[model samples]
Target: MKKIKLGNSGLEVGEISLGCMRISNLHKKDAGYVIENAMESGIDLFDHADIYGGGKSEEVFADAIDMSTSIREKMVLQTKCGIRDGFFDFSKEHILASVDGSLKRLHTDYIDILLLHRPDALVEPAEVAEAFTKLKASGKVRYFGVSNQNPMQIELLKKHLKEDLIVNQMQFSLMHTPMIDAGLNVNMQHDAAVVRDINTIEYARLNDMTVQAWSPFQYGMISGPFVGNEKFPNVNTKLQEIATKKGVTDSAIAIAWILRHPAKIQPIVGTMNPQRLTDIVKASDVELTRQEWYELYLAAGNELP
Candidate 1:
């Protein structure tokens, strides 16, 4: 897998990383298979969240792999906080306690990257800054970021945060293109013209922040993956045609479409199936031409004004 510097953090990581949200459902040996396959495919970064499976995913990961200092030194562990049972918490107390829990579960000394899972309407920038400062000073987290946040929200945090937010995790894929849609529509008169994300991709690029695309294969928030779904036949057919021509799986073509963008967005694949992970990793080697990229876009029910 090819490596890219994560935002402005100066940390090099694989273009494709593994998301460990569902690992809690797998057996220890099976979880080992997933982590082993990911490492074999050159995926050095593993993404996690404090609330995923009630924080069991992180525990499963540490259980499946030898997280000794020597082994952990080679891989990057990134996890998110600020999410609770029924509410979001970015308070200094919550942030510190959450990191302690994650460190214990993941069997690690420090998190390679820590992201505020989501925006807390009641968030106090100073409190967040204090949490980050303490975390940095304690050597519990090396870098910081925010997820599902707008440019303005990020700027608000950046104003008080001494450390640069190196990454911004957002959901982007062939099916979910709202982030890209608003930009393409411009002043056109249509539903797509509504800017839902305030040009997040453009904002991240200008500020030197890396946009990490999560859920790269899903059709919608709860519509499940579109790879072979009968309802989205047009996009699936197009994906297959491109995959056949490129000698890779249709999922690989879908992932390649995201990687084709100039912003260098990273696609986090959450598949636990070893075979599927291998198929998705093939995306790193496939480069989609401009025409092919637009073809997949149009096939996915997007219109160009």
Candidate 2:
């Protein structure tokens, strides 16, 4: 298992981390099995969220982890907060209370990384900074980051934040490449084609923040993944060709596409199947050539200018 330094924290984490959202209430037994397999395969970073299953996800994680001192010591557990009942909260009170709840549910003393789940429209940067400062001082959270946040939002927090923001979790994949696509389609007539984030990939890279790619295989927003789906024949066809050439499964090809970027993004894979997990890990080894990368992008409906 290859490890990369997480942002500027100097903490090295596995290249491929396990997304534990689907592990909790959705598939209890499968989640446990996948976690055990991740350990066996040397995956050390476990990702979670407070609202993944209405706090039930963390509860099950506590049960699944089940008091294994040795295992806990070797792994880095990360979770996100701020997303509440159809709203976002980044208040000092909420942040503090949320971390306490997460600690109790995960059955751990301190979280390795805590992310503001999303950008709260009504966030007070100073309040968030205070909460993070207190948490670090008291040993509740080791590091902090944000999810689905633009550069401006992160900059606001950074202004008041004492701890260095380490990671930014976002929706990124080969098929749904808006971060890449918008730039390619910039100045087009359509509003949807306009560039968003103003180059978030470049922003994170320049700011020394790690980009965590969630839903790494999805075809688009809220749509199912494109793997083996006839709806995206071109996407699957290209994936098949690349997989055949690399002698790896198509899932690994999809992962390799994201890993090939210069941003050093970490993929949070959501598969519970051990074989699928193993296959995705193979992406770390299969280096996609520049031509192969462009070919796959073209197949996904993005025309090169």
Candidate 3:
């Protein structure tokens, strides 16, 4: 697996990290098998969130890592907070309390990376800064980032916080690429939907913040799987065509399309099947040429002007 520096934090994480959301529901033996397979495949990063499986995900990870002492130092563990029932919370109390719970659940003294789950409408940057400071001072979290936040929202946090926010996790895939599409057709009024994210891909690179891709195969937000779904016949057809040419799985092509970008986005592969995790990690090795990359963009775009 390829490795990339996560922001300015100096922590190097695998280009493709394992997402642990589904592992909690799997049998304990099954969960252990999945994680162990990921490590053997050269994956050095794992992603988790507080709300995934109602905290069961962390427990499973805690057990899996505990089983292998040597592999623990080779992996990077990341998780999210700030998302509460019916709302978001970034206050000092919530941030502090959430980290404590995460540490306890993961059976670790510190996290490699910590992200704010989502944007809180009533966020107080000062309080968030305080929480980050406390965590850093006490060696609870080494790096910080945010999930599902826009450029302006991150800027707001930077204005009030002293810590370096290293990543912005967002929903991105070949089928749902408004962030990439919007920039390609900027200022084209006839195609109001053309402009999306307004160069968020560029913004992340400019700020030295790594972009983490979530729901990498979904057509939209929790809508449905687009991998082999007949609803997106054209998308799947195109995916297969490219996969055949690359000599890789259709799922690998789906992930490689994101890897082809210059922003260097890290995809969180949310696969619980051990074999599936191994298959997806090979995506890091699949390289798409400029022409092939644009082909995917055009196919995903509603209409090429």
lDDT of each: 0.94, 0.87, 0.84
* Lowest-sum lDDT 10-residue window in model 1: 216-225
TM-score per candidate, chains pooled? 0.99, 0.95, 0.95
Q: After superposition on all CA atoms, what RMSD does each candidate show versus the true structure?
A: 0.7, 1.6, 1.5
Candidate with the larger TM-score of 1 and 3: 1
Candidate 1 residue lDDT tens string, 12-40 = 99999999999999999999999999999
Q: On residues 101-220, what C-alpha lDDT tens digit does candidate 2 reach at each position?
A: 999998889999999998999999999989999999999899999999999889988999889999999999888787887777667776546777778888998989999999998977
Error of 1 at 217 (Å): 0.8
Off by over 4 Å in 1: none
lDDT: worst 10-residue window of model 3: 190-199
Tens digits of per-residue lDDT for model 3, 1-305: 88888888898877888888888898777787888898889777889988888898998888865734465577788999988998889989999898898888888888888999988999998889999989999999988999988888899899988789999999998888878766765567665355546567788989999999998988877797888888877778888998898788889999999988888899888988777677777888898999888877676656555
Error of 2 at 164 (Å): 0.8
Candidate 3 backbone clash number: 2
Question: TM-score winner among the candidates?
Answer: 1
